[model samples]
Target: MQTRNRVAMSRRAFAGSLGALVLCAPAVARAQSSGVVRRNTSGFKLHNWQDHFDELGKGIIISDTNSRVMQQWMPGGEMFIYPTSVPMTDELTRRGYTEITFKDPAPDWTPTPSMRERDPSLPAYMPPGPDNPLGARAMHLSWQYYRIHGTHDTRKIGRRSSSGCIGLYNEHIIEVYDRTPVGTQVKLI
Candidate 1:
């Protein structure tokens, strides 16, 4: 019994030491995204890169496939690195896009026209409803064209699959939307 305890203790010590070593590695302190910056997060995810901080003010530049070039704030250096992009650029503009316009007010993401069009078989959007995809609010970047918004589907949070809009968990997106406006520049490169 005593020997087994010692083995367990040793394993824990080794894991702690290895974690410390990884955090202290040169990989953490330096910029890996060309001119883009990197910051670590404490959110519980197994991947190191997925631990990147969230800085919505920091805009993101994405590849054609919706893959991102790390993340940075608009007009500033504050940023974080996320592994995914909303609707990802390619997916966003892939089809059914009209000229950009400013929606008079935010629309419900659940039963809205765009939502129905995207998924005819899916349920509808009703404001302040629990399943509302728009969560609390969505920053209307291009009228109905695109947005950065809150989501009820938290499981989809860091993945590349989205309509053509960026998805943030309800809390995070609401915080961002409150600060954004109709003319805000959303550059999906």
Candidate 2:
């Protein structure tokens, strides 16, 4: 009987301590872990894009570089530019996209090695570098081969000069690299 009483007391104490810790935790930690952001850099800093977030639903990704924006529509063949995002990392995991042939409609699922073979000049497929075609990070949409990647070409920051790929700046690419994870949704306009 005494053992049973002690066990009950211990359980109550544990519960009370857990409740206290929970209450003391920061609100940011409580935010959804579903988001992914750039890793190598310091904390991602972002500002609102003035556009209403309510109208957007497919998915939202902030630029990982400095202040810049590049939005593109897959089927519609249009890219909208605005200073909507800054170099802010998100804890966002996006849809899986392995680099394969750069087809408009991504080809069958394959590992991201074929891309390196296809563009042998684009440096070896390293994780985070100026030449890595995957850019600092890639936000994979439901689409197969397609991805929103950063570019070594600082000049292409606001250009739609990819074979159906969305190009981001280099530093911004790193910012995206830090935050994005494996299975996040991408709603490119």
Candidate 3:
């Protein structure tokens, strides 16, 4: 009788565990299918271009600092998303509307005044190269000292590591630079 009771308890525990797993299966499947799991560990959600743009004049770029993701919408309504490195802190972040003033295929780097003040050892100027912080390309924004640019340190992508700019992987920035044009509207949020 004792052995039979032990077996019944074990079976009940197994059934309960199995039931719990079955209940959780749909949520896991849904998250994976919806791209909330595989794309980013930061819980980044895809954005709709219409939410941030009045019209797709030229094109639009929206960088979400919270999610560390940049979403681009082309004139014809196609969209692309890329992971990004955002400002390291809220104080370093600049929000609101801006436009791409120009593009540099081989962008140079110059630490901003505040950046220099914070880190006096930083070089005053760096010419474009593999060693340059601005990796392969850069899209200058209307705001001075701000850019949506590539970084040599690929680890910075999908993290809060930039001083004030949005940083992308070198390959990703090259693609973005090719797709985006001067005067493309951008919003940082």
lDDT of each: 0.49, 0.41, 0.86
lDDT tens digits, residue span 25-84, model 2: 643342433332222222424433224233223334433233334332122222222222
Off by over 4 Å in 3: 1-42
Number of the top TM-score candidate: 3
Listed in order, each prediction's TM-score against the native is 0.53, 0.36, 0.78
Q: Please give the TM-score that candidate 2 achieves against the real structure.
A: 0.36
Better candidate number, 1 or 2, judged by TM-score: 1
lDDT of 2 at 69: 47
Single out the weakest 10-residue window by summed lDDT for candidate 1: 44-53
How many pairs collide in each candidate, listed in order?
Answer: 9, 20, 0
Q: Is candidate 2 or candidate 3 better by TM-score?
A: 3
State each model's C-alpha RMSD to the native.
9.2, 14.2, 7.6
lDDT of 1 by residue, 34-123 (tens): 554443433322222223324323333221223422232443544344433356335355432222234323457555476578679976
Q: Kindly list the per-residue Cα lDDT of model 3 for residues 60-131, writing each as its tens digit.
A: 999999988888878987666778999999999999999999899888888999999999999999998989
Off by over 4 Å in 2: 1-59, 62-130
TM-score of model 1 relative to the true fold?
Answer: 0.53
